[model samples]
Target: MPSTDFQESSSSPSSFNLSILSRRRDQVHSMDSPPLESNGQQSDLEAFQRTVAERFQDLAAAPSEELLSIPWIRKLLDTFLCVHEEFRLIVFNHKSSLAKPPMDKYITDFFERSVKALDVCNAIRDGIEQIRHWQKQLEIVLCALDNQRSIGEGQFRRAKKALIDLTIAMLDERDSNTTVSHRNRSFGRQSNSRAEPRSMANFRSLSWSVSRTWSAARQLQAISSNLAPPRGNEISATNGLNVGVFTMSYVLLFVMWALVAAIPCQDRGLPTHLFTRQFAWAAPIGSLYERIMEESKRRDRRNTCGLMREIYEIEKCVRLMNELTDCVEFPLTEERERQVKQRVQEIGKIYEAIKEGLDPLERLVREVFRRIVRSRTEGLDSIARANLQD
Candidate 1:
């Protein structure tokens, strides 16, 4: 092609592609060159391009910090935190892909925030476990306390009944049969008993009362050992809830944790699964809360029956306890003073047993409490030191 030919074609640059046929064809295209875009489809396309340019200009001019503060824009940051740590890392790939520095400020910010979020999540998890441990312990303790209380009440009843029965027997001696009338009646004389009294005047009656008391106690223990608890999840669960620890955990984990770990997860992988699985575990925190309420009703039913059995056992024990309180020096009527001395010895033996058993339980509880306290105290101390350093 001639130099003139190239110049003619270049004159209509928009139509230069069609110059394959003729140079004169290019001149004709120049004469018919489209006017600067105004109305119709051409203008609409031009306007769209201008709008795109303006958007880019505005984006460049905007302050990054202020832009990030936008509710719509801040959503991106929220997504970063709520996501699983692994998911976020994989999706964004850190700053390793950077040209030279390989350390992205944005990526580092995400790392720090994610770690903080995970820490918060862990704190929330531990808080829940602590609450659970305490609550379960509370159940066992309350049950034991209730058992102890039953024992106390039963003792009181036995003491009163014994007083009444003894008084009745002592007063109603005249209504006895021939054997009692012969054994203790003073041969129609008003002398002190040469033989044993009908009630507890001698060795045999005293021994018999002691035997009866022991027998009654054994029977009660047998009954209690066989007694079954209420067979429902209600009382057991509600008792668990009354622990008060669950509520505190709810506030910390659900309300506070949601705020801290609301990062989005766009990737799918094992790490992402771990994040989601961890979050899924949180579902129990919310869902089982309803179960806590249901537990209330169930507990009432089961406990009512259970409580009765426990109370009855305590009653029987208290009765036996009173009978055994003072050893029989043959009989209460014949020698109350001597019997009381023997009872003191028995009580001493029991007190020693109680102390030994209580020691281990007390020590275990103390150890658990100490560990929790130490961990918390150390954490608070570290936080204070960090603030001071800052």
Candidate 2:
């Protein structure tokens, strides 16, 4: 079987490479023939984490320190940290899931998927290091010009060359990972591999909840289709409208449920709900049925007008994102900075509008959960009261 573990290499980059270097160093240190000290490897990881945190703080505290004040740079660092943390968690969980040493081919393929995730992190780290190094070189150039010294033409050229090289390497890494991901998807389809979870929570309880919630949501949609209004029916138009509203509300609730199921994948903090007193709850089907009844009584109600309106709003927001993507391209020119800022603001506006629609959906789901808990509490109290009377 292909090695399920990350391969240990003889050489490791000192400062520029964070993700791969750390992993490589850890592997080498742990697998020394004589098995020296393990604490050293742990300390290395700790120091690397501290360095990354310090660098982030420095940039955040004084953005003026960097030669270029680009918003995307900060975004890049933030995204890198998020992905690195997630990949780390996945690796930790994967190791814990193993029964013993000598992982099977299936597990090895899973590890390869994780390595691709780490490859992206490594590229991000390399790009950040290049930017910081260039910033330092730019400062040196400024000082040389001020003091009337030789402009250090040789060093400046080298820095520029290094930056270009790093950019190319990063792009190549991304492209390679994309190709691997496509190949894996094709292989998975051929092999009939397990489907990817809707939520990427590493824990079994949370993962199971996510899978169940997603499955239920999809099943609800399928079932609701059969409940659709009959064509050329003898039924009154108002009754048809009521049925349509009823179906629409169920569809909305299921969609909301699916999004809730996905929260653990997007935000790892949500997994605590699985272990804590909190339970996964969604908007009650009964409440939606009641809303359908009320909405059907309204005169202006026709087909799924409200649902269609929400869909239109969602599409408009999607168009805004597409425009932003089109406006922002690679090979960062001077004009790209202004475009990045403008498009970022446009994205923020679109995010807020989408949040407006989603917030109510999430709130309704939570309210349903609260009602379930409350009713359970009340039932327990009534049983206690009856026991006392007895």
Candidate 3:
């Protein structure tokens, strides 16, 4: 009877627990279920707040000397800060040089945009809580740079045409101001000079030179046209390859000369209204052009450093995790192992996401830089030809 009672007790224990489980199964199910949306978000927010607070405290507690003792982090900070400082100087100096109304307006606009970009850099350099804001700012700055390039090109072209027109008008005025008697005397002198064989020789030499040049040009054209035609796909693929660079650099060269023309004329006691009008027209465009170039370069550098910054942060996280590993009790437990694995996986995913986001932005900047280089190459070629002719 005692053996029977022991067997029944052992068997009844399992059934009793099973009944309890069945009775409270709904309670267990509810506990296992995901929290309500609001509760989940609130919990997440609280966790994030706690994490951010802890991060801030940790960052504050870390000695600058110790942080800087880490070679890579020091180098990263130095390079980032130095580049941004240079960018700041460039923008400020450019803004200070601005003079006329339109120029002031454009400079202000560009300066504002540049400041926004710089703000992003500063935030990243300072190790802010949120990175997404700066990422968007970087994109905004890129768009602004592109827009500045386009508008600057347009303004420069207009100013160039206007300057050309003004120069022609001035020449016409100079000609009209000359007396008919002076013209007659000049014509008479020219008629008398025409009797000389030197003039005829000179004229013949000029004609021969012209004919030679024409023949050479024709031969070059024929050679080009006779070559196998490029496929439509090939041509289309390469068509806009250097558009941004060519557009900017083309007007850039012309803008330099226009600025030169405006400067001395206004300084040499020419009518203020005459030259200042054009100077005012062009000054804004020049500032915009410089701003575009500076900002584009800044954007490129920032985009490159962005990935490095993420890596730095990830390293910090990893270092902290490594430090805590020894402190964790029961490090061989399945739960602990799972948590570590999950964390490592999360860090890896974060790294991958950062890399993926930056790759496209870097590619875009690289393409722009390539276009600029191509434009520079063409400019050099043209300069070489001009020098040869001279």
Candidate 4:
């Protein structure tokens, strides 16, 4: 179980960092200047902040048991999509400001971060494909042992072979030197030679799939680099739009970091420090991050392929079934038969969970990939148009 501290912090709104709010208020009162933007613009910026905070708060408040489950990850992606659309509208309303000095710099930086995220999306899709392979092995095991008239030597042999193959595949994934990405084909490409040219062109346009040596940790670090909040003067100069850009940048970094933590990807490493406490949304996001870190550090999960709860359950089921098979005798005693049946039941439950969850989860990931691509193209075009008007 994750530490109880996260649950405690998330349950109460007062647990959020209030010092930042107080400090901002003090700074405002001390300034000789008037309000930074008109009341209307200020309202829009405040609404954006509130929406981000509310969405993350709901995510943080999830029961501990559901924290890293498939459904939870889907919810996380859904939150990102909603916030991203709102951010897009914010940018559209103030598109003219995007091409001006510091604002231009911020938007450019964000677009670059989005490009890096494209690679992360590709890596995550590969991880999903790897899980599907594991599922196939699970199915084989189920076929051998499930719905049998009576347990027999031949069935045990088949189950044992499937289990061994599954173990080998998982171990290979844990070895940092080996990764699914090495053999990964792009999501945009077809295997057919006739479609190769067009598919290759589309693949290149969506960001080329990451190479064998590319590290997810390094890519995340690149996104996080120099991602500082806008200064008060810059915020004022941009009519509060700089705050929106900063918010989206932080959101982008955190979402990508969480996806890597939850999915099996090449060279996965969690950044030690990723969030600041100054933002309204930071409290909940930080708590979720800490809890996930705690999960990864657990004794049994330390070297697993991924921190996803379904993966953990699968690993557990495999270990138990393997042990039961090893010690069982032919013409099994009633007690031994009972144990085998019990373990089979457990496996059946996990198998169903994976079957129901994986497809929806993959669809959500695909949607995320498309959303990022679309958002980047539209934002860049908007900025280009704004630049032309100048």
TM-score leader: 4
For model 2, residues 1-390, the per-residue Cα lDDT tens digits are 112121222122233233323343445446552331244433533443434433333333332222112232333234233423432332333332222222222223333332222222222232233223323433332332223222244533443343344334322322322221222110011122233333222322332232222222223233333333223221121211222222222323322322222111211011111111010011122222223333323443221112122222323333443444355444445565454344434434433433343334333334433433443344334434544555
**Model 2 misplacement above 4 A:** 1-208, 211-214, 217-334, 351-363, 376-390
Sorted by TM-score, highest first, which candidate order results? 4, 2, 3, 1
Q: In model 1, how many backbone clashes occur?
A: 15
Q: Write the per-residue lDDT of candidate 4 for residues 307-327, one digit (tens) a residue.
A: 888889889999998988889
How far residue 333's Cα lies from its native spot in candidate 3, in Å, is: 3.9
Residue-wise lDDT of candidate 3 within 131-152, one digit each (tens)? 3323333233223222331223
- Who wins the lDDT comparison? 4
Q: Rank the candidates by lDDT, best first.
A: 4, 2, 3, 1
Q: What clash count goes with each model?
A: 15, 0, 0, 0
Residue-level lDDT tens digits of model 1 in 52-71: 22322233233422321122
Least accurate 10 contiguous residues by lDDT in model 3: 263-272
Better of 1 and 2 by TM-score: 2
Candidate 1, residue 297: CA error in Å? 0.8
Error of 3 at 184 (Å): 73
